[model samples]
Target chain A: MTALPPKLQDYLDDFSFITTREERADFLIDIADSFQPVPARVASKPYDEAHRVIGCESEAFVWAVERADGRLDYYFDVLNPQGLSAMAMSAILDEACSGAPLEQVANISGDVVFAFFGRDISMGKGRGLTELINAVVYHARQRL
Target chain B: MSDIKSRGYANADKLVSTDWVAAHLNDTGVRIIESNEDPLLYPSGHLPGAVEVDWVKDLNDPLRRDYLDRAGFEALAGRIGISPETTVIFYGDKSNWWATYALWVFELFGHTNAKIMDGGRLKWAEEGRELTREKPDIGPTSYTAPERDDSQVRAFRDGVLAHIEAGGQLVDVRSPGEFSGETLHMPGYPQEGAVRGGHIPGASSVPWSRAANEDGTFKNAAELRAIYLDEIGLNPEEPTIAYCRIGERSSHTWFVLTNLLGFGDVRNYDGSWTEWGNSVGLPIEK
Candidate 1:
């Protein structure tokens, strides 16, 4: 298996040390607080349906912009104001995948959702978050 | 949405408006509880003085498929600082989907002094109501809960089978795709998909969200009646069973039928399609 991006691995390592649900929730909520939606310069309202993440109830959308160095910078927006999990997953992907090697970004497993959100998440929520990850990976794989 | 009383529900007291909740925010006799499918929702920001009762973590038994027992219920009630007389008002995301689920679980322990906040979290927030990140400092109470009773509002597999055999009313609160066997689960939600792709025999199709308006509040009595009775031909006097993929959605429908529509006898088959679709020799129809 391909190695996960170093920053993502660091996040997983940090999350691994957490033992309680409250701790995990606080950590993820902090990440969610940092989430920034795609700016008007990158994409505005009425985003193209093509970029929408399928299967995500959060109404999340993703975009990948090629940088001068050829690595991709990912931007995301979750339309649902209450979709904190989607926002958190989006923030994590934007941090971990942007400017990373395409191969490493493409190989980031959807299972990392469980690592961040924990297995106790409802089936509907788990599937939606995983689909968010899949959208990012799809963008990376498309450029490969 | 109109006023709760103006909505003309058979039992208007089962639902309280956002205004009612705002007025009762400091009511010592009422406990505001937030329940949601999204775990981060409660921690991020919730109604002031509202405590979170997680559907998965707080309500369900960790080691079993069932709900918490009497002892477990007591522990939870005590932790939430609620007595039998406390009026528990539940509200959350997805049109109070998880809220009703929690309320249903509370009913298992005979916590009947409960009501759903109409329109749930979205409505409250949209109306510019205050949401707080600060958790309340609750003074725990010693709650003496009755034994978990499955007979009143719950249905087992065999009982559902008997209901179908006896020509009882069954409401399948799943999407059209799931009802028609075109999809095993709601579009894009395959994690909870069952082995089979159809619904139980002799069930009427009514997606649970139909019971709610666009603002997350429930439809008025006339609108609900047009769908559940006029459209589906459900008799209010007959014993009825409602089910969905895992019973959460059906709990919403169960609430509508029992409290809003004044159905004489209604039960939620919590096992639902996950159990019926996978069980051996169970009859299913597209």
Candidate 2:
């Protein structure tokens, strides 16, 4: 397993509970465990240029970074997960790519993707944004 | 009691049974807000520990008519003992319409711990849960209200005009009858004779009744997914807007989409048709 990035390492340090990637995944799973979730399918792909990966299904947009260690850092859109206009999706892509070391995160097929995490009573839209940022920064931490 | 097999209620998670609520009626942190805004509906009776909040006056600010007021909402929340860290359980006798609206209002202002009691007061009373005639003593608490995001919500007039110009999805949560021009008595809206007495252009009608059962409680998760994903064809990743006559019914739909279905970008157009039909400059599409 590769080490985490400094920026993402700093974010994990700030959080009182979660630490490792498995812990983060477990946290999401626990939130999903609260509700009886419906069936959902997601489609994912890699953005080689931006040094990041992007995924989308009809329901959500999930973007991530592929590290040299083969770990996937995942970012997702919880607010508008299904389908977004070019303008709206463009803004989201820009926000996700900002300050990140990704070579590119673009909509190649004119389609956007969002990954449905799990049902969390406390996970608001803001948490969704936080999850995406955490995913990207953590994946970028391979060098550390 | 249609079938009463409990497809919606029995299968749902995040739902508090009337028995559960009745058991914990006196929990200190659990503040119940009475959502009966209708004057005729409110005066009759309410659940124990439930405080009244006017859907229009207390919850929303008519001056801007587009968003909720932070100070006004915080004051109301404080008066009801809803601090930022409080767990608010909302209920109402008049179905869950008002209760759901209150839930949406809390979410808009960044109060994430709010939940609507399933079946609301109707199921509680029906199941012999305690009902208090006299209002309870509510100690005021400090609730810091957050500013509502205007981009998340739009007034019906501007929303429709924007839709016509920009072409986003318009989701109308009114009954098929209302959408088809058969207007029942809609409060604070153009009822009798309007220029074009139908829904907005390209607006898909999904009756609010589809969301719940004959009882006031919402349907289960799988059922809701089918209704939104399969039946109504709502895509969670898409930018969608919900609206009703005054945004109450639509707020319920908004709750289902954002809270239950996990659709991130769902916004309720608070002005709804009341502001839309009443506005002269906006184009009317039957």
Best-performing candidate as measured by TM-score? 1
Error of 1 at B190 (Å): 1.9
What's the residue-level lDDT of B254 in candidate 2? 81
Against the hidden reference, what TM-scores do the models get? 0.98, 0.58
Which residue runs of candidate 1 sit more than 4 Å off their true CA positions? none
Model 1: colliding residue pairs: none
Candidate 2 displacement at residue B126 in angstroms:
0.6
lDDT of 1 at B127: 95
What are the per-candidate TM-scores when only chain A is compared? 0.97, 0.27
For B1-286, candidate 2 gives per-residue lDDT tens digits of 3222354432234345566667777888777777753322333356777777756567766676544678877788888887888777777744577888877777777776877777876677677756655667888888777786455543446555776577676678876766876673242222433444567776788877688876777776678888778876877787788887778889888877776677767778877766666667666555
Q: Local distance difference test, per candidate?
A: 0.94, 0.57
**Residue-wise C-alpha lDDT for candidate 1, range A1-144, written one tens digit per residue:** 888899999999999999999899999999999999999999998999998998899999999999998789999999999999999999999999999999999998899999999999988888989999998899889989
Docking class of 1: high
